[model samples]
Target chain A: MIILDRRQIEDLIYLPAAATAIRDAFCSTSRGEVNLPPVGHITFPQVSGDCHIKYGHMQGKPDFVIKIATGFPQNAETEGGTGNGMSLVLSATTGAVQAILHDEMVMTDMRTGLAGSIATQALARSDSRTVLIVGTGPQAMRQIESHAAVMGDHLNFEVWGRSASKAAQLADKLGGRFAVRSVSDLETAVRSADVIVTATGSTKPLFQSDWVSAGTHITAVGADAPGKQELDVNLVARADLRVVDLAAQCLDHGEMSHAAVQGLIAGQDVLELGQVLLQAATGRKSPGHITIADLTGIAAQDIAIADVVLKAYRAKGGRDV
Target chain B: MIILDRRQIEDLIYLPAAATAIRDAFCSTSRGEVNLPPVGHITFPQVSGDCHIKYGHMQGKPDFVIKIATGFPQNAETEGGTGNGMSLVLSATTGAVQAILHDEMVMTDMRTGLAGSIATQALARSDSRTVLIVGTGPQAMRQIESHAAVMGDHLNFEVWGRSASKAAQLADKLGGRFAVRSVSDLETAVRSADVIVTATGSTKPLFQSDWVSAGTHITAVGADAPGKQELDVNLVARADLRVVDLAAQCLDHGEMSHAAVQGLIAGQDVLELGQVLLQAATGRKSPGHITIADLTGIAAQDIAIADVVLKAYRAKGGRDV
Candidate 1:
């Protein structure tokens, strides 16, 4: 079996291909061709750490993947500081392990980043050029980079965060090749951008309903846990189309849950991102359509990315290529 | 992280220590100190294989474990053959992975054998002597060896199988150090033995209720999946004390389920092996007490054995030693 450490995963993971694989995974999922069991959540209350075991396999796929990921909020005060993970890909036919990817959270970021980009590509207007990203964390940065990779180089970016200096620093990093601006006003960034991606870890709403534009596509990447909200319930109610990375999970714990709890939208009304990708369901109704894609981060994306990474590794003749 | 291949697992795994760890795990489980999620069963009909993801952690323990096990029945006809597995032990405090034990299927066999041993020691009468084991499989052999290891060297053995030659061969391998005899008459073997351990993969009952001797402690190690049975319904009802490795699981797919379905017994009435170990529940009531331990197997046993194996590997100072 092959092992890919963090550096190897970083070296070989191609964002464009990852986005395409993720698109297929989501599409397969919507078509009921994916077998993803309910995630196993083990909570350590004493240390406030949680480990989630997610497994998934697509029909006719050569491999199935199981990922163990842990998040410790207390790690932020210490040197370790947060989440890390490892994933295994097993041969479907013989039930033998194929590879052990010691991704160390890189694949997760890559998959989520690609999910955002893919969603934007399918749901956002073709002529859309302005982008606004919320937060300045690692996830937010990856979303910006991955979106750039999938959507081409002509788009301008507006970065917003709680910390002004960090937001400016993020804008400066992407300033070399693109139009980058750090915005202090959240409402202005939300209203003006053609594509809005929210990646902040928040318990309260950050954006309102009226601030969003008519043709803007929003990818809500945060609010993965219960009681986490990125956009107000009114914003969700105002969305012309609501899509989810994974419908079951997103409806349970993602931003959709907030809207569902408030009776703003029923879960059945929400579309799956895969459905939009395959055109089995509508994505953007018109140039003035407003779409919301709630990102809960499913196991299908993880396995799909693992397949892409391992395939690349094999194509290059094994490790360290 | 320490990775122990088949050879390393064979070298490092000590059954007596594993039985004790398994004992602790069960005791903790009965006391509700163990956090074990429902086993994730992902079936692949295309390959005729299935992968089960199981996770468990005992409160106040330093480690938690997740095991991914797959079974492909068609592999037996081909090269790969039946079962393969991998497990991870994570730090309970930080949720950081501590060791990766690439134990093929040795730990599984060892753990199951140890479970039989532990259950026998705890539930069987102290003066137990004659032993009758059905089937000449690896599990049946291990049960004989492990039983002798725990009970005493004074015990005699009777081996029975569908083929008398296979039974005689098994007896020949064990005859050197102990009183081992191959018996063709199943009734004579069942009636004369003080302990009966059935480990066959039989779809029908292997022994009737009247054939069983009084005070005989039976460990039904076979019948792991649905529709598999090694003993008749009457034999199950005849057991004075019915103990399960895990009550919830056994009552669903194990021998207890058979009894429960036939209106012979209620699931809640089945005793837990851990309850017997902790002395919280009655084990053997008298010298003539007939007992049955339904060993469907569980993640607790897997994690417990993982703990013991990892500790042994770390104690021997690392990778090779």
Candidate 2:
């Protein structure tokens, strides 16, 4: 069997193609065409782990996808860091060992980035030119990449990080394409940007309802684990349109969890990203509407990305790709 | 991140010492001192998967063991056979990455053989010399190797397989010290042998009640998966002592599942092998008593064997040893 190490996987696999496939996979899964199993887990002491498998068609693509993922506490004692995750892929039409990937953190970032980009593509105003991103980690960088990929030359970017140096470094990395700022000036960045992305690991909310301007789109990707919040409950409640990757996971562990706990949004109030992507439901109704998309990540994305990785590997003569 | 291919893993690992160490680990885990979590899974027409994290002390060993295992069925499609099964092991005290093993089937065979040898040592009469093995696959060979390792000079072997060639081949290979015989006559093999090992992949019972004579000690390892049976219900009902690897798992999927359903053995009738090993329960009572050990593979065995493999790997400087 062909084995791809971390470096090869990161360099050879195209994230843009993976993102597109994952978006389509999510849409197809929501239309009752996918075989997605309920996640199960055993948790105790300092460790918790979960597994899920999903199989589905992607629009005109008739292939099936399946993935398994596990999460350990970042502080847990393991040779690899606790958040390390891996996925194995197989072809649905012909059973073949497609690919094995060590993209635990990368998978999380890319999928969340795709979710944000998809939401922005559908919901953000076409004329939207300025973007504000909160957080300066790899995930924040991916959000910028995804936004630039999808929005093309229509947007300028501003970034705010807890550490000013990190934010400036990211801004410099972006070159003249965007302007990056520090958390001290986050208010100015948020007020002027037409779209905002929050990608922090904060356990408390970073954005207040009063900080947001009218007709702005917000994508929150950081509050994935339980008790990890990145947006104010009031901000979520006040959004004219709010979408989530998976309604159940979002309500239980994403930005919507706190809002649901406070009765700001009932279970049925949340709309799925797939529903919006397929045009079965409306996204941004008006240019003046406040939109929020909460991305908690999902197995469908991993399965989709795995499919792409496998195909890419096969196309490259099934080795080192 | 040492990745060993199938051949490398097979060539470098020593099973005899690993088997012994695994047996000790299981004994230590049985005394209510393990730190493992319960295994969980979701199975449906669309998807099938399980995730588990387990840790516990083997009944008689000082070191505790832990493992995380997860798999998705769709993975098999990509691999061109069965989906991949992967597990990570950690040292309980130091919490270091001891080893990572792939292919659960191989791990299962090794650990089950170790368990069988451990039970044979504690339950079989010291004078018991002849072994009747019921299958001729890798598991059967492993059982023979483990039994020979522990029992040493006190063992002679007779093997029966559906394929006469395989049985004869095994007999020829092992005949030098053990007076090996290939028996098409399964009845005579069972009746005359002191220790009977049933390792076939039969859905129906392979042995009848009349075939088992008094004082025969049967180690049935084939009835691990659901719907698999190796011994008639009557034989199960009539055995004087029925020992099981895990009473709960046995009741659900092991040989005891059929017996329990047929009302041949109550759930409480069988004793756990761990309990017997720790003297919390009894095993063979008299030389003339009929005894049976139902060997259903368990996660405990995985944890135990992983601990052994990790120790050996480290002691040998982490190379294939």
Best by DockQ: 1
DockQ per model, Cα: 0.68, 0.14
Runs of candidate 1 exceeding 4 Å displacement:
A76-81, A172-181, A225-227, A319-321, B77-81, B162-182, B200-204, B223-228, B319-321
TM-score of predicted chain A against the true chain A, for each candidate: 0.93, 0.84
Q: Judge candidate 1 against the unseen true structure and give its global Cα lDDT, from 0 to 1.
A: 0.83
Query: Candidate 2: DockQ?
Result: 0.14
- Alpha-carbon RMSD, each predicted model: 2.9, 5.7
In angstroms, give how far residue A263 of model 2 lies from its true place.
6.6
Q: Where is model 2 chain A poorest over a 10-residue stretch in terms of lDDT?
A: A49-58
Candidate 2, residues A241-288: lDDT per residue as tens digits?
989888888899899999999999898888998999998998888999
lDDT of 1 by residue, A1-321 (tens): 887788998888988888888888998899998888988888888987788888988888888899888877676533223667799988888788888898777788889888998888888999989889998877777888888889899888899999999899889987886777899998888888899999877888887889888999999888767667898889888889999988788888899998888898997879998888888887888999898889988889998999889988888888532
CAPRI quality level assigned to candidate 2 from its DockQ score: incorrect
